[model samples]
Target chain A: MGRFVSIWFRYLRTDWFSLRQPELKKLPFVLRSPSRGRMIITAANSVAAQQGLHCEMAVADAKALVPELQVQDDIPDLTDKLLRRLAEWCIRFTPLVAIDPPDGLLFDATGCSHLWGGDDKYIEDITRKLQARGYDVRIAMADTVGIAWGVARFGNGSLIIESGITIDALVNLPPEALRLEADVTERLHKLGLHTIRQFIRMPRTSLRRRFGQHFLQRLDKALGSEIEILSPVHPVELYQERLPCFDPVATSTGIEMALKELLTKLCFRLQRGQKGLRKAIFKGYRIDGKVEKVEVGTNRPSHHVEHLLKLFQINLGTIEPSLGIELFVLEAPIIEEYLPQQEQMWNESGGLEDIRLSELLDRLAVRIGAHVIHRYLPDEHYWPERSVKLATSLQEKPSTQWPIKPRPVQLLPKPEPIEVTAPIPDYPPMLFRYKDKVHMISKADGPERIEQEWWLQQGQHRDYYRVEDEEGRRYWIFRLGHYHDKIYQWFLHGFFA
Target chain B: MLPEAGVIMILNRKADILTELQSDILRLQGFRTVNNGLLDADLGVIKQAFPNASFPLSCIHEFITSQQEHRAATNGFLSGLLSSLLGVDGVLLWIGTSRYLFPPSLPAFNLSPERIIFIDVSKQRDVHWVMEEALKCKALTAVVAEVKEISFIESRRFQLAAEQNKVTGFLLCHQTKKISATACASRWKVSPLPSETIDDLPGVGSPKWHVELMKVRNGKPQSWDIQWVDGKFVPIYKTVSLFTEQNQKAG
Candidate 1:
């Protein structure tokens, strides 16, 4: 049997949910959910564990142990999703990663141990990397998956069993380490066979007759007498390249140079296949085993090295390659067909500068955020707010004609209520008090009766009036509902410049 | 023989004129140096308030209100100046702590408030840095900062940046600031005058301001009761009534 590694995430359900929310980590907490009309504790954090509270215990008992224990509902599905994501991240270390149910991952290291120096060093590298990202993990390597899983969960810290000694390693451990059913372990303890060494000494026929065939099968798997197939989280075949440095690179320039060379090779393969990447991730594994990753996205599928380099440049300053990075891995997770781009840009004096404008926009969007830069296109709605819609791209054209009516420079998100005094309900206010200032109206424009769009389920008709104050300031105010109705209200909405 | 000799003398004088023209062109292009203080292009808008000459252009001007109540009128005057300077092409950047501008009210001062880009910064330090950067951009016509009184050094830096970039700046100092000297082209205080109704009509007239030019770098201090009508500023009769407690008390 080849060497296999088991990664154990202790209290996985508790760790995964509290991974992002660190405040809850310090408190004695338990994650419970309503099942069969009763809330039972599913998992507990390190704090609650010191209080001697265990899983499957009633919430009443856990609370009795620690009165102020905080409780949250468990999300088993989300924990499974997080586990799958961690499995994907494990690919950065080795490709043959499989999900060992509940809280562990099994990896068939095989001949890959030499890459990280040896089997022991490989375990240390992965442990440090996972711990740096704030995950509590224990790892064990052995000749078989069963023994590795047993040692990882029950062994001291991390252990690598000697080759062909899997049976001897399990002899000292309790019968529970065999992954036996609770009742079977209890029955063996009553029979004065608490240790696996005592149980293995018995004849196979006696053990099989006492327990079932499943118990013998588990025993055989752990002893390396049985073979188990491992299914990797990601397929073994993917377009990826890895470069291990002889001497670590500490500066940004060195990282950029390495990145450029790596992209040159990767893009060459992509170009040969006529494929372009929509998303590219550059990962730098520091000598201390910490991985710094920067991801960039393009609006369109692109394989242009210079253009992709420009996008990556925006993220270069953010990556902190502490100590020094010893390896670089670049992966293109999203790719599409590459098509020739046309050069005709409509911006005045459009040559290289127009292309630079898009690059600048990308950099600016990265800095100030995406929502700040918006392109507007006209919508067919008569209501002013719905008259223009935000366009996702500059190339989008307005489907409807822009309203010729003069629109205010800024529209209030919500209409503010104001006191009004007018001769008639249908007319503009002769005097209005807004924010404790009275503006006497001089010139008035309309009662632009705008009925709500019939397609909308519910709304009242509004009559808008654009009135100029004594100071020559103009305001767009509207009266809700019918003017003749006593329940109608007036609101000041927009400003006219 | 004498006529030919006179023609040669005239040709030599023409050659000297060509050399003088070449040096003048070089000076305009900045290839040759000009005196530092003499390069201020401020006389253009100075004539608006100061009758003797006028406030300097291409420089930062401080606008202060006499009382806390005069903020709206001072803002109106600033808006009017911005529109005059911007004319057609450039946009004005107004950096302030809070947004108190009502766009519909801007047309009274003949300003199109829509052309102004408002930058609301929360921190005190970001205000100065953003203002300085905004003033450095040549594409902008002017930058107006509504910061709680800036320091003299910061004002000098703003003035120097404005002169270099040729973008005008208005520093609207609030009432809370200590009255100190700054390196600005000029400073003015504006107070609102009660509107005058024409033919005893019901509403107030165009906005009028009691403008006081407190300090002028290279011009005489003056005052004007100015009114915003049509699209230009015109002198109006001074009124004693100010918009104060009487209206609020009446309500």
Candidate 2:
């Protein structure tokens, strides 16, 4: 079985210093500064020099021995954030990516290295590319994860421990290489344990009783006696596409252009997979300590780039760039495939009427607001008012005609009251007042009685009359209820020519 | 005021041409103008004198050969006079007639057909309602009604509706009534005049009109002969030389 390996580089800060000065790559110098005013010496490779300056000495005393010593405040958070961004950039190398603590990346290159011309070449290309981009990097390849980590940190001169040879390769390194704390190492040193070889050669039961089982287990793993697994920083299921700027982009327009490129790439991948995207999220990371993110949704599944751009256009106003964005990524949730609509020759002459109507409704809904425009349909009721239904314009059209009686051309929103004075049985009121006008009838017409729907209500009966005034003006007036009742009321219904 | 004066000047110029045309036509001897603006008197007299005069009924009448021939011979002769008569405020009554026939090829005079109300009542009792309604309305320019028969009481009612409505009643006397019997304001006979060939066109000129004055309420009954030209009535004259020339042409 192949051993799981994890490698981490120590003194990445010092490496960064040497990377800034290419001519000093092989020079042996230690970085020193006293701990006064929160300043501490960040690098000391040898114990003699560490004692000379003293780990917690004042800057004035440390500068006495080495007057040209270099000092830097520890900024672990900034370095960690930078390492994350660098790890994200390495995503193109392999999808199985993980972050190791303190400036380290763990890539499961088991099956991915051959695509980039083998594991050795892939590692060399990665380190050389990062170096060109002003990053200091140290890499190691080993069969076991703990051994690879120990080799990358302390073992020198291109150590490539072959599969199943982790124990022999890590035996010569110091006990600190087994990832033990300083206190543990000191206690082990007091017990005359100087190197990992001597510690591993000791009896296992005695080691366990003295240092606990956790320490022995960690040491055994470092020497390839056990196996290990790393949980990747990003899962394989997450779909992401990325764009790296050749130069640091500091403008909104530049970031937008890079975003479009990234979105195009992501959409193409989705289409090739026979999938559609329903939502897309864009993240713009700046060189400075700032991150901007935007998310947009679509009503329908689409792989069309223009439509995705339009959705992003609506959301672009909210993303704020504090410094300037240098990288862009677009991720999407993929949906299943749907069949395309087949076109008919007849329909080609003039497209489907439903589509045209839907387009018109969409425009109207946008202009007048969604709820203002409505369509009326027949309801399953006998009463006139209750027989009509109103729905918003976006809803589909109802397909049936009204079942009620044929209504007049004009209908008053509400009925108005009138006053009538006449004997009821023979003819309608000979004299009536409507809208503040009193008229006497000269010629009278028939009583076209339309009864109220009894199934809906059993209450009232109305008698309608067409009456001509002395001036030849005609009116359709109605009396609610029978004439025998004292509460019988008269109302003017409509006009006739 | 200045624009009104200018408009009056233009009107005076138009009236001069009309007066000149009238005098030239009156230089001859046979024509006359009766009851100057009383359209009912003119219609009654013309109907009494010539009952066969072409009158359009509906849009379809314009297709009839007899009406076309009659109108061709008359040259839209009565249209201008009738249009002028109908342009007033009154109820024009065409009583006792079921339908008022229309002539084929009757030149449209742009008259408002709504002004003429048709009341078809075979029963004599309904004539009271028609007359009452007509009398109640003063806005109607004419009321052409048909009835079975008319009496003195009916004639008085017709007069009342016409006066109250400020309208002219064209009472088409029934066939049973004697020619000199009905009490109307005036009566006459009208017919199409002889067709005259145009000097320059292949077709003949518009028809000429020959009207005979059979009776008048207050004036003497005299016949008027006229010709229609460009939608206007021009009196026909009978000079010694012109008459002899027309006679030779006829012979």
Candidate 3:
């Protein structure tokens, strides 16, 4: 008597070993074990035929029963590689991927898969593709990986397994399909429980006492009676690189030397990926469960190894590598691609100068912080302050001319307050004092009223005046609109030549 | 026969040629200082005198000390000069004192706010170094420097530097009570003039000056009593009554 060695690929490696065969639909098929001589009759159209085939018939006997049977020898390693490739392809769908055992893939395709149309269409496309490539495929999607696996293997057409129908859909399937061991199932069958429905109908306590709780617990998972989690194959794409040291390297200098090598490798990867890292994180995972992470930030996006090393050099003394770090991983979260403008070189006069300027800007950005250093850009607004914006240096230079207004040579950072005494109707103050100097305006021009941009709440409405003092020093001033019981306030905004 | 005829022709030509030469010399003199003492003078004199000469007029004036108060005084003095310079179109280049000049306060003399250009050198060794370079560019009308101690060698170099490029150079120096034995054509010492009286208030009054021409290359150096008013220098001509009366009253 040959012992049945039921090897379930667990839907994990099906992509690797299963031959593409769309023509095998509703056909009788058996995946036979070449080594152990056991067989899995994966499909049958009717319950009687399935039961008849399940009665421990020999492969030759089963082939005699169907006559038009399809058979395949189980190859595990090939199937595993195929599963891994499928998992890699699933990355294009969603980054979160996990390999489900016995031939299944669990993808957290949330908010995704819509790009390939709806979930049904996405699954249909994948199934059709796999079938065309000569493989037998069954697909099911559910809230839980366990339910999804059970439905794909057992539940046929339109196996939605609606929120409340998990148990119902899984009821008629065999107890063996619940991932129970053959010995356990045979022992349960001796107790007159064969199908999952009959076993599930039996008192939970009796079944637990007779065959242990593992069988029932697995059944509950299969029936969505309990929650199941699919372990993710890859976690979040953290900005980290790691290196394991062969020799337990001690000393800060040794760590620094090792870190330089790691940084070079990491930066090379980043450069190849066209990314400039603003922050570099070097984590030294020790043989002990201790982790030391040292982080440094650049003012601008930078992948220059020397500059990054110099920045890390400053903090080298701070990291106390206690028992020596065995692994080093460098990660950078703030990354931007290096976008150096391609020079036309048509005129060729300022090519060298432009290169020099680019180098200067890069150095400045590294020292000051990319965001902190900005260039003045002319804005379209008529207001003097709003007419210019602080722009990041990396953006393409704007090709706009400066405004034609007679603007002041220097604009104050913020409008200075002025002591003014004026009448209500004409907001322009008659006399104002600024910087502790009183100016009696002999000549005044302007009522250039600028309306507030209502969309921006902090905007102010003002009427400006170009006033000339007795000695002819000109000033630009404005009066704020009156509100509530408050009188209009006057401010010396800028100066005029 | 030719010698005698030539002698008669020469005699007849003498009187006619003499008058023409005299008139030509006179015309040149008037044009020589078309704006006399206007091109090179202190802030008070420049403000009172050449108000219309095109901007960026270089005023060769010196500050006696590097004290803050002295610096402020120098700035105030330059501010008045710049106000006058801005009235015309040209570039004002200040050599040594570039660091001290502020852009905003220079509107008084009408210096085009944008026209003022400043270049500073690390050492006194580079004074002539910049003059030749600056003068080579026709964009600038005036160049000013504070070289209080110019040896004969440096002064000659500077004069040569200015002459080659035909650009006016103002060399501000400390007052030498005794005239220097060098080749500078004119030197003027500017002291604060008596404040002008407007009603009971004293506005910036007539700029009084004791103008001494240390060396006049083509003429004699003499002391002239000059009063700068309405942007023009005029000879005061024995005006002692006003000061005497004010002094007697105070006494």
Per-candidate TM-score against the hidden true structure: 0.45, 0.32, 0.37
User: Candidate 1 residues A1-497, lDDT tens each?
Assistant: 59999998886777766776888778898999877878899889888999998888889888888999989988768667877888898987777889877788999888888999988788899999988877789888999988888888787543888677778788877888778899999999999987788878789998899998999999998988889789989743365768889999999999999889888888888778777787889999988888899888765556778878877887788888889999999999988877444323323322222343344445434544454444455668777656656666644545665555544433566788989898775667789988899988877767888788979636888888877676556567888888677788888877553
DockQ of 1: 0.03
Docking class of 3: incorrect
The DockQ-based order of candidates, best leading, equals: 3, 1, 2
- Listed in order, the DockQ scores are 0.03, 0.01, 0.03
- Give model 2's docking category: incorrect
lDDT of each: 0.72, 0.53, 0.55
- Kindly list the per-residue Cα lDDT of model 2 for residues A124-173, writing each as its tens digit: 77777877866555777777667777777788766556656767788778
Which pairs clash in model 1? Answer: B42-B56, B42-B57, B46-B54, B46-B55, B47-B54
Q: Whose TM-score is higher: candidate 1's or candidate 3's?
A: 1
Error of model 3, residue A262, in angstroms: 1.6
Question: TM-score of the candidate numbered 3?
Answer: 0.37
Candidate 3 reaches a DockQ of: 0.03
Across all models, the iRMS values in order are: 7.2, 24.8, 10.6
Fnat per model, in the order given?
A: 0.01, 0.00, 0.00
